[model samples]
Target: MSQYKPENPATEEEEPDTLLMQLRRKEGSWLDWAQACQTLLQRQKMTPQVIFEATGFEPIHQNQIVVGSQVYEGMAKAGASPAVLEYFGRKGSDILYELRILSPKDRVQVAELILNRNLNADDAHEIARAVKNYAQLRERPEGFGDHPGDAVAYQAWKTAQQTSDLQERTRAIGRAFQYVHSDGARQQIERLLSTVAASSSGGSQRKILPKLSVFRLEEDLPRLLPVVGSLPLSTAAWEQQITPEPEGPYHLIHSQGQQTWVALPAWSVIQSARDPVAIPIENRLLGTLLNQQIPPEEAQDPVLLVVDRAVRQWQSEGFFLIDRAGSLEVEWREDSGSVSLFGRVLMAVRPPRILDEVVAQDPWQLDE
Candidate 1:
């Protein structure tokens, strides 16, 4: 027996191995428990409502993040690539829902359209229709002859997509008739026009023009009376008097917001008053041509003089007071390459706030 028996510490110490074994067992047990819970969830009898009632486990409220996460996971399970999943995860359920309904071809087209630019849902829908119709027309021999509606839809869609300017888009859509010729297609075109008109008519009413009354302090009236001044006070007279020479039939389009007074020479107040997008191309081109025809000597100084005289009248004698709720500033824009100016003066009169700033006294003050 004789050589002393070797004692091994590895055999003696079981704590570490036992602890690891115990942990593994616990983990396995936990996984089994999770599987059981998942199975229960899959059963119709174990609905979320039932689970809540039976175990008081309240369901998580589906906020945007939760909804998005679930959609992401579902898409992932359906074999969508990581990139595609992440891209769509940023859009809401409405867009995803719309995509899910489309054929793979349309889905790809729409996804590309969305990825390339900023578009609203309506725009996306329109562009999608255009894409689909365009595809159909390409396959058909008759083209717009067979499907005039598709021709109109495609033209409107392409114009809206390509042009950044609204007026240009309207002009382009108006020209859609050149592409489509069938009587049925004409009806579709008419419907589109009617829709546009209805929406325009239903939009917010124009802002009320402010009541302007100029007055002089009772004490200053006597001293200022001798130095006479002339200002076109009424809105109509203001438009007439202030119009630049090389004469335009300029009229004021009074809207309450930023572009307070858009003075258009030839177009109706409605045409001028609305956004540039609303104006037809013909009108815009006409306006530009008219502007170019004016001689520089005649065009440059008249409108500025009008504003200058008005400001002077307001400041004259501390004798003038304008108790209105807005401010006025003149702005001029030259077409990108042309020498002519699109003259406009902004007047924003917010109700309930009167802006009164001191106008510096003119150097040549004539004393009574």
Candidate 2:
């Protein structure tokens, strides 16, 4: 018999965690897809004044500084560009954010993400009439990403458009246990199963680990992450509407009256949500998601004390997801940019980094 088992039972490679990780990362921004669309469209209809008002930044006039090629000090540079490095000799606040937003890279990212992943051709140009309706929605020059043949799905779809049948490409993707799953992934699965089995030993299972899950049993014991409430008003098709305006990038205070928008940092915003107590507040989002993976009533509490002050966003450039496995936790990657417009909800899935910090030093605190 061979000494090594498969990485994953499905395929015998290193492991499939990387792929799953990538997929998770991609989907991380999906919840915000609707909002991104909103952002792009609003740009056109929104005047410079509106932009200033919405983002709270005043425009600056000419005579910019040039300390170095990369550095610009003193007065602003020439021309009435859409953005100014400094306004009337005073470096404007939030201009740094706008520069990044207006960068070609940002446009490319949004374009690829939306066209490649977010929109379907019909929703895109799939239905001619649907295309007309979508056309009514403004798409800005800043948008990049999708061309006619850019997306893989779009590639296959366009072929299907010209061809008679598509039983081939869809069939190709079905190569399951034969081509997927790596060796390391299988070992991890084995270790997890063993651990779950060990945990299943009733009272003997250590409380520090909670009860482990063996496929279905794990979901039953709670501790899997919850998804709380969802914002989609309807489970229907092709209708657009906006409600709930933007608030400041405040710390999403679970406390009352504190609900008003405040000029808080991104780190503060993320950190506040990490608080286990905030779970009840976040139950709408996290709880709903968790309920799908694990049962709602049965899930164990995280027993974490979220650190309010020490909390911070990563360079004001990212988001995190916390994947709970009863006791064991997993952190997922996300790329949520900084910019907390009012009224919009900052959706969180998993954030083990923030959660880990909060969970340290036994939160139970001996019945004070």
> Among all windows of ten consecutive residues in candidate 2, which has the lowest summed lDDT?
61-70
Q: Local distance difference test, per candidate?
A: 0.37, 0.28
User: In order, how many clashes per candidate?
Assistant: 2, 57
Tens digits of per-residue lDDT, candidate 2, 87-145, equal 21233212222222222332233223333344432332322222223234465112212
lDDT of 2: 0.28
Structure candidate 1, residue pairs in collision: 166-277, 167-277
- RMSD in angstroms between candidate 1 and the native structure over all alpha carbons: 26.0
lDDT (10s digit) by residue, model 1, range 121-157:
6655555565455656545423334342344455663
Shift in Å, residue 85, candidate 1: 3.1
Q: Estimate the TM-score of every prediction.
A: 0.23, 0.13
